[model samples]
Target chain A: MRPFTVHTGTAAPLRRSNVDTDQIIPARFCVRSTRSGHADSLFADWRDDPGFVLNRPGHRGATVLVAGNDFGIGSSREYAVWALQDYGFRAVIAPRYGDIFRENSLLNGLLTVTVPIEAVEEIWAAVEADPAEPVTVDLERLQVRCAGNVTAFDLDPDVRERLLHGLDAIAMTLREEELIVRYEASRHPALPTTR
Target chain B: MGSTLAQKVWDSHVVHRVATGSDLIYVDLHLLHEVNTPQAFDGLRAAGRGVRRPDLTLGTEDHNTPTIGIDRPIRDLDGRRQSELMRRNCAEFGIPLHRLGDPGQGIVHVIGPEQGLSRPGMTIVCCDSHTTTHGAFGALAFGIGASQVEHVLATQTLQLRRFKDLDITVTGRLPDGVTAKDLVLALIATIGTAGGQGHVIEYRGAAVADLSMESRMTLCNMSVEAGARAGMVAPDATTLAYLRGRPGVPQGAAWDAAVRGWTALRSDPDARFDTSVVIDGAALHPYVSWGTNPAQSVPIGGRVPAPADFADPEESAAARRALDYMALQPGTPMRDVPIDTVFVGSCTNSRIEDLRATADVLRGRRVADGLHMMIVAGSAAVRRQAVAEGLDRVFAEAGADFRAAAGCSMCAALNEDRLQPGQRAASTTNRNFEGRQGKGARTHIVSPPVAAATAIAGRLAAPADL
Candidate 1:
């Protein structure tokens, strides 16, 4: 995972709410064992329509997505995050996000910014007015800057620290090997074990 | 302060605590299914890592497995490769898997509880969002992503950020014809989709206590749809009865001791919660979603709501778009809406009790002409139980297709069991998102009884209506 510190990229405005993972990468496209090819299937259901925002002229190479409330609302599939990253999106800015989707994005290095609806509206306005308007997401500052406006966002400090460095949470977890082994020794005997 | 049930389970599992941010909690059980998880195994191999505790992990073939014609090799190339990879991966890791055609093989969530892998006071994580289903036994369970799955596979632990506690009290007995599905749908409607954001909900009160173990599982399974981190009901006699003599349950004296311990796992009366919601359960009717999202629903006897009925601009816009996609007219009675298909299966409501409820409704009835109905069980155990009770005969005689094997038949369109472009279905699945059943299928989420009743009426109708 590449560390996400500060990124400035062109924006694509998606004026839709509850944009679930199913639509991000449909179930049919989720078959492949690998994760990279999802870029082609991103929004596979909607891309056929010429009027879809991603297909619009100026938004072609966007690396930031500004969407409505409740983004990534369904399915725990991390493929949704991979699809966005595969499509060159460094981050996603939304008013709200599904709890699981937010965690998935953090672990996979896709920055999920939870800004106020007003800030989301402001960013969308800026992108619609000028499709190539640069949006800056500063993880170090916990802020988003676009069109001369600075909007603050909130992320758990631990998550921010982990993202600042490319995290290996499993390795970090393994550092407490002694504690884990002790706890396991005393765990309930009634618990199920595949062994 | 008095500790809540969620707090008790969470605090008990902490192997190590970080200074001010998170806790390294021990995971008791890690369930795996064959979808979106192949990458996790690939990562483990690349890093030269082996599973830390294969004893605590179990895998199954569910999400993408074929429900019918499964006796032969899986016909779909993609589905076959996934199953093969799952068999090989579990074998390589030395983890036990309930493979295809195995008696224990079924939906991961369903078989876990049936085989007693999901019991009280344990911390369980799976890659599927419906993992909250195990919380019915008072366990702390939630879904994780691919990276977290790998984290659990490699270390058997998860770095956790805390969630605020939400206490949802459902008082009074549920009305007749109202099942757990309807009760949960009602709760989600009261609290919008994002209402439970970043909170763990502990469902309690007389109404919840009266529910069966399977009903409690149904309630917890859809907690994710309401945007909750997880949902739980404290273990009780009902939970004990369900776990007695199941596969992993301890024997005789050991079981008694386990019961004594689980009996103590409950929220104190004075427990403090960040938020509270109270619902009068007796007043809830059989709910059926009219639009795309689960919250966009109303009582069975009510009419479809107009967009103007919503005060929030975003909700109003969403309602309008939902109506357009649903092809439904405002002011139309819900019972008047026609459905071309009826599907009764999913992690949400595919247990034996759910199947029994569907069978009770369709016993002497026939599916209406021109309607396609498929009744899939949650597990082979559930399927066999249904057969012993003659529910399969009831379904077949009613012109409904009772599946031979248990898998996620049509809840998702992972295989050939899906609707065509523009077909509308009254489904018991947890989701009704656009194209969920298939490419252009519109789904109205309902309970098992409601699904069976709608199948016979050829429209959205409650059993009482019939």
Candidate 2:
């Protein structure tokens, strides 16, 4: 995972709320190949319409996605997060996110910043008014700034630390191997196997 | 202070806690399926780590296997590769795997409890979100992403945060026409999609206690629809009776000790929760989804909800979008909504009890002239039980298609079973997300009885309506 401290990029606004994982990347694309790029499959159904925001010329290279509340609502697949990163999105701003999706983002070093719905609307309006304007998301300071207006956001401290240090969870857990072994040994051998 | 069942199970599993971060909790049982395990195994190999506790981890090939053909090779290239990869990965890691031909092979969620592998007070994690179904036994079971799957495989633990407890108590006897599926649907409909976002809900009260183990499993299975990854009901006589003779269960003195432990796994009488909700079971009918999301539902007798019914602008807009995608009109009676196909199987409601319920309804009734109805059992064990009871013959004689049990068939269209464009289906699956069945296809989430009646009526009809 790449360490993420701060990133500045053009923002693309997705006005629809409850944009589920199925819409982020459909189940059809789920079978293509493991560990392959899914950029082309991102929002495949929605992209059928030429007017979809991401398909428009101005947002072609946008790297920050400002979407509505209740984003990533269904499915626990990390493919949705991988698709966003594959499409070059470094940060996603929403009023709320599905619990599992948010966790996946944290582990992969893709920054997910949560702001008030009003703040999200403001950013969307600003990005729509001027597509060329860049938004800076500073994780170190916990703020999202755009068009001379800035909004402070909140992130779980542990997740923020993971993103800041690019820590690998497996490596960290391995350090406590003895503890795990002892815990396993504590369970009575007379008990049935949990499997 | 007394602790809720969730807190008790969660606290018991803690291995190490960090002051600035979450605790590392030991995972007792890890379940695996084809869709999410392949990439996870790849990650484990790349990192040069073998499974820490292969005995505690079990693998089964689902989500990509064909329900119609068990003896033949998988025709879908991706499905075949995923299944093959899972076999190789499990073989190399020394994890016990139940293959397509194995009677124990079925949907991961189904076989876990049926085989008595999911015990009370245990911590279970699977790649599939519906793993919450195991929580019906008082275990703290939830789903995880592929990355978390790898984490559990390597360390036999998961990084975790405590979740708030929400006790949902359903009182009174369920109405004659309503089933446990309807009760869960009504709960989700009342509390919107994200209502239980950060909480673990416990289903209890008079109505919940009266339900059979299979019915209780159905209630816990759809907890994800309300944004809760885990749902629990304390184990009692109903749960113990269900597990008495199942495989992998302890025997004699061990059984007595196990029962004592499970008996103590309940929430204390004075335990407090973050939130408490009470539901009247008698008021619920056979509920069905009218829109793309599970929360967008109404009773079978109710009409479609207008966008204006939602107070929040975002929710209103979402409802409108769902209506558009579902091609449904506001104020239309749910019973009048026509369906092109009826699917009576999924991890949610594909057990022997579900088959028996559908079979009772279709024993002498004929499927509507031009409509198609399909029945797939939850597993080979379930299929065998159904066959011994002559449920398969009842389905075939009633003009419904009876197929073998495989992974996730129509629930997710990874196999040959799928709805085509512009087709609408009444399914017993958990999610009704856009194109969940197939591209341009719409799904109406229903229970098995409702699905069978809908097939016979050629529309969305409840068993009482017939």
Candidate 3:
């Protein structure tokens, strides 16, 4: 995972609530042995429709997905985040995200920005007016700014730190391994026997 | 400050809480499945490590095996290789395996509970997220990744940070038609899918207390949907009664002592929770997801929401997208949404009880023309019981497609059973995410009776219609 700060690229409006992982990366595409090749398959069915937002020629390189409320629900498939990353999306701006998907995304280094529903609408409107205009997601300030409008949201401090550092849950746990080892030794004198 | 279930389980297992804020928690039971076990086995092989406690570890083939044919070789090479790998890994590591052809073979979640491996106050870990289903027996169960699987296999312990407690109490008697499925769906819909994030939810109150063991499993099975770490029900007579004389549960004097310990596992009368949500069971109706997410649900009689009614334009747009994907028209009654298929099996609702419920609704009825209905039992044991009770005959007589054995069939398209592209299904499975049934397959999460009724009506029909 890269450690660069996220600056939301041009916003592409996709007004859909509850955009589940299955829609993000269909189950068939998930059959790949390696997890990295799913980007091209992201929204495979929907992308074929000329009317789909991501398929529209003008929105080709848009890196920020401006979506509606209750996005990324369904299975805890990590491939959904991988597909979004493969599609070149650095951030997903929605009012809320499916709990498991949100955690999966954050753990995998995909930026899930939760703005208020009003703020989400404002950005959606801005993107709708001009699909090429960019929305800036300042990681340091934890704010989203677009078309002279600004909104800030809270991220659990631990999750925010892990995202900024591009560390996974395992890595975060491993960082405290020494302390864990010492604590285990002291607390479980019979640890070897259990093993 | 009184202890919560999460705290009680965590405290009992914690070797130590270090200054760096990590603890070594002892793991009692480790469950493994094909999809994620290969890498863990490889890691162990590479490190020259043997499974620390093979007796405590259990393996089953579910995710990659073909649900249709147990005696024949899997035609899907990839699926076959995954299953083969689990077989070899388990054999090499001396871990007990419930292979596809064995009567013990079934979904790991179902097998563990039915075999008496999932006992109260135990800490269980598996490679699959739905492992929380074991928490129904009052154990602390959750999914871990492949690396963690290897870690547990080698060390028999997990490093962890404990979670806060959230008590979600559902009071009052459930309405006649409502089941545990409705209660969980209602809870997720009320709280939104992320409402239980970072919390270990303990299902309490009259309605939850009265649920059957199988029903409780269905409730805890979807805890991941709410982003909860796990969900547990304190063991009571209902739990003890279910465990008594099971294949592996303690016997005689040991059983009495086990019950004594389990009885004290409940939250103290004055126990406080970090967060609390109260629900009225009477208000819950059989729910169906109109959109992709479990939270995007409404009562059977409700209409799909019109985008324009949303306060946020973005939310409106999202609703529009979900409708487009689901092929549903806004403001349309959900009952009117035509379904091409009805599936009544999954870890969520494929037990003997669930099968019996579906049979009850399907008796003397036939699936409507053009609808493809499938009933896949959760395990061989469940299938055996259904057969003995002649439930399979009822399903067959109703024109519903019935399979002989069990695996995670239709619930996910991991095997031969799948929905054709653009197909719509009413499924008893937990998720209704787009393509969950197959590529471009649209699913509506429903209860067993609703699934059976929809199969009969050839659309999204209510149980009351029967």
Candidate 1 matches the true fold with a TM-score of 0.99
Per-residue alpha-carbon lDDT of candidate 2 for residues B249-342, written as tens digits (9 for 90 to 100): 8789889988998899989898999988899987778999998889888999999899999998888998999999899999999998998899
For DockQ, candidate 2 versus 3, the one ahead is 2
What's the lDDT for all of these models?
0.91, 0.88, 0.80
Candidate 1 Cα RMSD (Å):
1.0
lDDT of each residue in B10-124, candidate 3, tens digit only: 8888754655566778788898877756766876777777786787788887765676667899777767777788888888888888888788888888988898888888889
Ranking of models by TM-score: 1, 2, 3
In angstroms, the error of model 3 at B287 is: 3.2
Ranking by DockQ: 1, 2, 3
Better DockQ candidate (1, 3): 1
Q: Give the lDDT of residue B40 in candidate 2.
A: 86
lDDT of 1: 0.91
Per-model TM-score on C-alpha atoms: 0.99, 0.98, 0.85
True lDDT of residue B307, candidate 3 = 76
Q: Model 1: how far is B32 from its true place, Å?
A: 0.4
Greater-TM-score candidate between 1 and 3: 1
Please give, as one word, the docking class of candidate 3. Answer: incorrect
Among the numbered candidates, top TM-score falls to 1
